[model samples]
Every structure is written in C-alpha cells, then in structure tokens.
Target: EWAKAFNPFFAGENADWLAMIPFGILALILYYVGRELLLSGKKTRA
Candidate 1:
C-alpha cells in the first residue's frame, strides 16, 4: 500500500520504534506552541 511505501521503516530491514518517541514528543510540543502563538496573535488583533 501507499502507506507502507512512505513509512520510514518500510525501506529498511530494521524498525526503530524507540527512535520515534522523541520525534513524537517534539511534534506535540511544536503543535501546542504554534497553536498558542496563533491564538495570542488573534487576541491582540481583535
């Protein structure tokens, strides 16, 4: 399937599930920070 083709582990013989933990955490932190900044900007403009 297309999903497997794009997966980082699909092309490799080994899958590093543990390596994804940090990246996942970073992604969540970035999402929250970006959301907060966007909301703050809107409040100031209003």
Candidate 2:
C-alpha cells in the first residue's frame, strides 16, 4: 500500500526513467561539489 503510493518508477504500467534523469544528474553534481569542497578544506588546513 505504501509502495503503491510513493514509488514513481513503478507507479504506472511503465517505468519512469525520464522522471529519474534530473535526480541522477543532481546527485552527480552534488557529489562532485562535495568532493571539491572537502579537498579544498584539507589543502587549506595543511
């Protein structure tokens, strides 16, 4: 019941890859930004 209410990928008869693309891009961008920030902090500390 909860799965049916919240799961977008499996909500309809087809999988929603289009809806998931922006989220994937955002995640990758966030990961790279976080990594760069962490590295810059370590360099400044050293």
Candidate 3:
C-alpha cells in the first residue's frame, strides 16, 4: 500500500523508467567526479 505509493514500479503494470531517472543522473555525476579526481591525482604524482 504505502510502499506502492512510494515506488511506482511495484504498483504499475508497465516498467517505471521515470523512477530510474534520478539514479542515472546520479551515476553520471559520480562517474565524472571520479574521473576528475583520478586525473588530478595522476597530475599531482607526476
């Protein structure tokens, strides 16, 4: 009941792509930040 209200994927027949949008955005942000940190560390070591 309440869980369904929080998560559309559980209550709906169709896949909830919208619910995953935030995850995708967060993944992209983490990827870029990690990449930048790695590059900076390499530059500092050299």
Candidate 4:
C-alpha cells in the first residue's frame, strides 16, 4: 500500500519525463568533467 503510493510510474499513470531532466543534465556535466580530468592527466604525463 505505501509502496504503491510512492511509486511514480504506478499503473494507469504516465511516466514523468520532466523528472528526468535534472538527471540528464547531471549526466552531461559528469561526462564533461570526466573527459576534462582524463585529458588533463594525459597532458601532465606527456
């Protein structure tokens, strides 16, 4: 009963795409940060 109430994708309800926007942005930021760190490391080593 409590689980059903907290579940966002409950039956008959459409999934909320808006809720995922922040997560997508966070993923992009992490990707860029990781890329920069790797590049910096390689440059420093070489």
- Look at candidate 2 and give me any clashing residue pairs: none
Off by over 4 Å in 2: 1-15, 37-46
* Tens-place lDDT digits, model 3, residues 1-46: 8967776766765547767888999898889888795344545544
lDDT of 3 at 18: 65
| Per-residue C-alpha lDDT of model 1 across residues 18-46, encoded as one tens digit per residue | 45778999888888788795344545544
Residues 1-46 of candidate 4 have per-residue lDDT tens digits of 7645776654325446646777999888889888795345545544
User: What's every prediction's RMSD, in angstroms?
Assistant: 6.3, 5.3, 4.4, 4.9
* 23 Cα displacement, candidate 1 (Å): 0.4
Cand. 1 TM to true fold: 0.46
TM-score of each: 0.46, 0.46, 0.48, 0.47
- What does the lDDT read for residue 29 in candidate 3? 81
User: Where is model 4 more than 4 Å wrong at Cα?
Assistant: 1-15, 37-46
In angstroms, how far off is 1's CA in candidate 2? Answer: 27
Candidate 2 lDDT by residue in tens digits, 1-46: 7766777665765557857888999898888788795344545544
Name every residue pair that clashes in candidate 1: none
lDDT against true structure, model 3 = 0.72
Query: What order do candidates take by lDDT, descending?
Result: 3, 2, 1, 4
